[model samples]
Target: MTHAELVFVPILGRGHIVSMVEMAKLLVGRDPRLSVTVLIMKLPFDSDFDSYTSSLAASVDTARIRFVHLTCENTDAEISSASFLTNFIEGSKPHVKRAVAELVDSAGSTRRLAGFVLDAFCSTLIDLANEFGVPSYVFFTSSAAFLGLMLHLQSLQDEHHVNIAEFKDSAGELDFPSFTNLLPTKILPSIVLTKESVRSFLEHAKRMRETKGIIVNTFDELEPHAVRSLAGLGAPAVYPVGPILSLDGETKKKADGSCGGDDIMEWLEKQPPSSVVFLCFGSRGSFGEEQVKEMACALERSGHRFLWSLRQPPPQKGQIEVPHDYADPTEVLPEGFLHRTAGLGKVIGWAPQTAILAHPAIGGFVSHCGWNSTLESIWFGMPVATWPLYAEQQFNAFQLVVELGLATEIKMDYRRDFRMESGVMTADVIEGGIRKLMEEAGGERRKKVKEASEKSRKALMEGGSSYLSLGRLIEDILNNMPLT
Candidate 1:
């Protein structure tokens, strides 16, 4: 009997892990001989998982997938600190090397590791694949446009115009032809400025450039310029297979609580198209109490119907209270605002985001600009209001707002130098942006968003760009390896 091909290891982060998991699902669905083992920090369950997470967990189990947790504690500090980001970049190769070594040691002679697929950030795993005599494929989750930006950044640093720990605004445009406008040095990934950051990026990019093949979560038609540029890199053959989630059916299991049953789909079904705004900050982004209250006020005042997913606030000594000015408006809001905008909004501690976005009632999204969120929104034919919080989000926002022509930038206090500490955007700015999106009839911003939504739908249909790419990816995988 032929053995199943197992894909082990993932870059630690919600967005990275989610995209990689979708790729594994694609491989398994294409052939009976394939199977996948996902090594994550934690599985999608506890003794009692929430409805959304539980549904995700059940979907994995139904697919006959294997789960392995490295049990590494992904601390908040580890995710946020520039020092930690640096360490992760520097240590990723060694970390993957050790993890794969452990996997090989634990597997008996009967179980073969087969081929390995890893994230672009996991550069060291390529060497491990070489040692194990398995083909290695690098998976880049961001759009091709961002990859082009990274390549350009490498060139700029090579010329010594920019250095680590020192990045002045480059008034001139970026030299890359694929770029639509002058690419400022400010929007580049943090790991490209300093010598240490540059070295880390170079190490990983070299591995990717030298690897045998690569897969990008993008469709060819959507980014032909950037895609052609990457294809010219000459080392790895780039395959664009994307809109993966749209190809996969929803596998939500029903949730039963003592009060009643809650169906996320039903909630979405009850809303109107382009009327319900869905808000979700990526998993790692957090805000102070002040920012949270301001966000709530903006949503309430925008006069738009909405669904917001918020994290549980950190514990304070007494009950946390909104400022009196906000509280006096409406109780459903801070203290009294719900009565004013009754039935216009619902702010849950958390919502099933994917389910909500895929709903017919959801016309637009307020997103943190995580790549996964960007892809999901496009797949659902929904427009976005880009509010990037951190990391690659700024780059993602640029792609959405400037390159893709699908979203508007939520003007925040982020400086030209990209510092976040000294600024806090006020409720007025937030309210103004939302008001334009929801109410300003015939506004240019609204018209652009609507057009993008229609285009995205056409892109995912039969023979459409995303659909054809998915077929090509499956064909490549299935034909390359025979079922036993």
Candidate 2:
């Protein structure tokens, strides 16, 4: 059978790339006649992704899914600027248009061209898909709630021309449709606060709604209301094909950094079951040196066994894209801090997050509340103490703490640049939040998350909501093709 070929494009962000890659893997596995080509836009600062993709291809059936690369100028220095993100993605259009056109023109291409499945930020490619007479689908790397917020914000700006600035001081709640109750205007995305961000994000939202379908990275069981809101809004077709996650699968599991070889895992193995607290931010997650000191203080005072994968502070959004250099905890942490917490916890440079979350030794999570991490924690039935740093993480934190009631909050007010300012969470409050999730209300939170975990599992199982949605998507792609 000739495979139906779908091209997927992702913004250079790690989370966006990861989920899309997983989606590609799932598509090929579900239908042998479906093939995916992921076009990777390589930034100058990003390492040669060719070799990396080569390795990834070796791990999978390369005939089914292969990665293509397009080298684009890395606007590293500008990524921190509000307009830089807009500029970066928009800049990829010409190169992407050419690359995609070449793929469409290839005479020896064995697969039937189906359509495009692109990252939310890469909506610029939709025009190219249209020009090529191929269907265009969009994949949202975040939650359905975030999707609703995007639409609401765009309508608020474009349709109403209501000043987004007014929300800054308004004690009134955000009128975003996905939320069950009023959302404090203050906790709205930082992007909504500025004109450039508003214009760019609204543009992305508008383009997203124009796609043939919108694929969200959340299971129906996890975000029923938000998912319903997305579908009911009369936008492009909505498919909830996630918690696109795996429990025992190798595709989702990182190696033994969670097993006994690492000191952190060794310590975890020795600790009593469900006693150790796991703290990790996203791959780009970092805290200031001063904030790191405070975290040390909090961990020490919490008197909880712990595993911390600490990385250096990230550059500002518009600044250089220098990567994190993991330092010895003893060197970067407070003097004598490692010695003090020696027996009580373990601090490592990097962690295999999936492994740690799966370990029975883990009791609670202190996290930055990125959706991937949030989903992983929920998938494992572990409760969390949220500490949001940037992007829509505050909203994710809200979804966990307020909407789902499965997480406690350390501090939601900490903005993207809080490291330059100061620690919003004092050691006391940090310790308190950790304890509340691990001790005071740990049982209740665990039960809620476990139920969510089961539902999320079933949603992806055969004949379940997520599985059916994915099947429908594949069928739609296949049916849309011209009969050979």
Q: Cα lDDT for residue 478, model 2?
A: 91
In model 1, the runs with Cα more than 4 Å from the true position are 1-4, 42-57, 61-64, 71-79, 83-113, 158-165, 168-173, 190-198, 233-235, 246-273, 312-333, 412-419, 440-484
Please give, for residues 248-356, the per-residue lDDT of candidate 2 as tens digits: 3233223543433355556677888889998988866777676788788888988988888787765454343434646455666889988888888888766768878
TM-score of 2: 0.92
Q: List the residue pairs that clash in candidate 2.
A: 79-317, 80-317, 80-318, 81-318, 219-242, 219-243
lDDT of 2 at 387: 87
Best by TM-score: 2
Model 1 — TM-score against the truth? 0.77
Q: Estimate each model's TM-score.
A: 0.77, 0.92
lDDT of each: 0.61, 0.78
Which runs in model 2 stand beyond 4 Å of their true positions? 47-55, 74-77, 107-109, 246-261, 315-323, 418-423, 482-484
Model 2 lDDT, residue 244, Cα:
72
